[model samples]
Target: MKKIDNMTVTQIKEYVVTRQKEEYPNLIPMLKEDHRAAVKKIGQNLEKKTAARDQEVQRIEKMKSIESGYYDQGILNIGGIDEVGRGPLAGPVVTCVIILKPDSSRLYVNDSKKVAKKNRETLCEQLLEDAVDYAIGQVDCDVIDNLNILNATKKAMTDSLAKLSIKPDLLLIDALHIDTDIPQKAIVHGDATSYAIAAASIVAKVYRDNLMQIYHEEYPEYGFDHNMGYGTAEHIKALKKYGPTPIHRKSFIQNLGLK
Candidate 1:
């Protein structure tokens, strides 16, 4: 019988549920609609905060997974490896290896595909500043042609691990396991599912985007700045008109009759 204004949010919620089940049984439809609308309004105010907290929890859980592995072996070095530019037509495959602190709080770290370019850039900068160690390795067009994309991707990953300032006891790779003596796990769709892999994905993507932006200045006709070396209609038309640049992967162009 107490007024709604006198009740706490939780009390009000319980009251609403109880009323729906007991006093409002005859008005179930209207009561249910009102309850839903009130719950939605409360959720609207809390959704952003709730999402951030959830992301933090997910990040911590991911870190704990890696930490558990390290703790079992009593070793601290753990690395995450990911690659970008695999599907692009006119750029090198770039891979990044990142050794993060077990308790790093790098914000806005998520799958590169899920983040905007500006956010990725900001995260990349913050990651570089906060990471224990990180390295980038690139395999160019000629190497990609000779070794093929799979092997080239592996090589890029290996090279990135090699360039790391500190050696890792555990390697978390995105999908492809490199041929290495290092202890490694290949996680499918890791960029979306694994925090470490997502961080590495962001690093690799930002690095390759910058590289392609530089290439754009040299080959303005291909629209590398806009498309980032992808096979967009503009890029393909430019290839037909002016032919492939030195940076174009020859193997990819074979299907396009540009060889």
Candidate 2:
């Protein structure tokens, strides 16, 4: 005689499971069918709630993992570095260095490419506010063409780290090691796997995106805003028609037979 409508989904399910067998002796078959229907509805609701909680827990666990690593090292001066524009044909290669607070373990930090753009932008702003130290560095298109992307990226990372107001005791770099006296680790796919690298990735991505948007205003013909200096069909067509711009990497264009 208890009202099922007032009970939560979890309570409804528990009640049904516990009472079904005992009530079978006295209940009509129709009543058992009603119990089955109630149980199914409750199960669906519970599953949805459980899934949402699981996702939240996973995000928390990821944040804890990063926090624990920094705690274990006992070093407050940990810097994360990441680069963007390695694959782009035009625009400068950019890198960012970020030193997060030891106690500020925020969830939802992951690779910039894995996250939505809006979330990346939001996180970039949040990290900037929360970081103890942060800096961005760039190597121009001419320099990228002269040194190549690999070396250019290294230089950008180094420059970003050098500009940091607080010196870092440890450097966590994404995929490339820079020549520095500071202890460093070059982690492959670090942006995807490490929280620190992921934060750095978002900063670098947002910074580079803003720069490309500015370039788009200057050169609307090449669609810099849409392609971000990448070699899309539109970009290639523009290159063929207008020739290389100052921002275009001459080495890459020469290799592609466009220069």
Question: What is residue 222's positional error in candidate 2, in angstroms?
Answer: 1.0
Cα RMSD (angstroms) for every candidate in the order listed: 7.9, 7.6
TM-score, cand. 1: 0.78
Model 2 residue 60 lDDT score: 52
| Model 1: per-residue Cα lDDT over 87-147, one tens digit each | 9899999999998777666666778988999999999988778689999989999999999
The per-model lDDT (C-alpha) reads 0.80, 0.80
lDDT of 2 by residue, 1-259 (tens): 4555556657756665666434533322333334467655555554555567568668756744754676687877788889888998899999999988766555577888787889889888888887999999999988987898999999998898889889998888877878899988788988876667788899999999999999999988999997999999999989988888889999888877886
How high is each candidate's TM-score?
0.78, 0.80
The per-residue C-alpha lDDT of model 1 at residue 167 equals 88
